[model samples]
Target: MNALPALPDSPGAYRWFYADVTAGEYSAVFIFMVGSLFSPRYSARVKRGALPLEHCAVNFALYHRGVSRRWVLSEYPQASVLRQGRELRIGRSRLEYAPDGTVRMEVDERCAPLGKAVRARLVLEPQVPAAEELQLVPGLPHFWRALAPRAKARLDVLSEDVSVEGIGYHDGNHGAELLGARLPRWHWARVHGPEETVVDYHLPDGVAPLRVTAGVLGTKSERRPLLSEARPTSLTGWGLRVPAQLYSGNTVVGTPRLLESSPFYARVEARRDGLDVMGEVADFRRFHSPFIRWMAHFRTRVERAA
Candidate 1:
């Protein structure tokens, strides 16, 4: 029931499915973008009436102890994308929304820039499934859904010759306008506790943050007061601002570690109280800058054929 709806064929319309798994020392995240929301090309061509479906992409990243181990963001020709019901395939990677209610991901991709092969498979069985659709921004066309808040997961990295079991998560996002055109910036975090998982979305638009917790059999979602940082925010080498310290109520979330850092996006992890968190702070608007868009190309591989 959580599979994405049929995509819009409008020039700026897009949809993507995202899944992440954390197993012991290994954590992996992947995104299948039908309209390529993060694509600089998409940002550039939208005004020219470029079809979002014509710029499909797949992004995969592996992390170990808060450091990037492998990364791939490949853009392929529209002809390379295949969709059969709730199942989708772009290039060599595939995602299946099965009739049995399990989600499966199979990836065979080359790490960006380096071109080293990274292959993996992940099966996620949802223990807590989120059913409602949400507005990513107030009165915006962007929609967000958490398909699985907590799942029993198994991840196998075939090329790396590794396998492990851990907790996993899945979500879907889609919108009618270019991402940068709809929202300026945002911070999102997912923290997993022994008995619960909480995902928070912080958008500084004079609105309370959206906080969702999956603890028992289902989930509790509400508007939460913004978190206060203990210390002043710090700037990254690329000039992005991030919290120096974070607190969940009276308790600190722990020291944050950088997993991936770039000019417009960052992924970090923090641990304490047996809680594991993965957070992302992004500036979609900055991606529209000519310089930033130019820098984005080196990290993305263009696959012209299936």
Candidate 2:
């Protein structure tokens, strides 16, 4: 409906970072984030001169064959300062940003809960210039910046010395604000085609009074707005929906196949207007606290979507 909001003048005031890598029919998602709320409760605490309240969390997940192994660490660090940077470290794992605009990531097996040791080292190189920062709300309080929408990745992963090397797709996002506070629900998907990459976000009526859809198509020489109509369809097991098609006016441009589905997300392989698509889409509601979901008037049960 309405045009997306302008960029926030002070995006640096908050803290967040996310990086995702997918290769050889498997994918990894990593996130480091700090969220602050300035609600009446927080304001009252501030009036009483209480310490600032915030939440910090780190999440790393690996997905393959309808199975996911995730490590989540969350805490409320009282009187601790939160900072944002190109480098992030949690436990034995680390993600670093290099001078050449590449991101290097290393994860230790100790972070995983069970099974043999799983270790990884990956280098992500951007294939196109960064997309313009997009402000999701009117004040740009929270935004999504697609870095390396299409990337070439070199990865070496070992599970008890068994190693695999392959190329993959890389993308990232940085934002400020409690996601649940900003929108009730949304669907996001990225397609890494042979010659290009396409990314899309669909904010349904629950996220806002009006439906909002935004996306980008990235090629070797340029990144442009995706003028096609894209939406999720074909509900699979566990209620996961796949990105059914991309359309230019009334003409179909692409179609996608469900590759994997979990409790709150799904990965797909798509063919869009002659370009191949491989990516994932997620619904955050499933990840929220049970109480929060009840308060938000949304209902979800924890189940294996695979």
The estimated TM-scores of all candidates read 0.93, 0.61
- Residues 84-161 of candidate 2 have per-residue lDDT tens digits of 344555445566767677867676533422334457676777767666666554453555666566667765665423
Q: Model 2, poorest ten-residue lDDT window?
A: 297-306
Instruction: State the lDDT of candidate 1 residue by residue for 1-306, as single tens digits.
Output: 535468668888888888888889899998888888668898788899999778998898888777787898988767232344767778888888877789988888888756899898989999886747778777888877778888899999888887999999888888888877868888887878888888877786666678778868688777776656434678888999876755554457976677888899988787776777887888988888989989999899888757
Candidate lDDT scores, in order, read: 0.80, 0.47
Runs of candidate 2 with Cα error greater than 4 angstroms are: 1-16, 35-58, 63-86, 109-116, 160-168, 206-232, 240-280, 285-306
Give candidate 1 regions above 4 Å deviation.
79-84, 226-232, 246-250
Looking at model 1, which ten-residue stretch has the lowest summed lDDT? 77-86
Top-TM-score structure, candidate number: 1
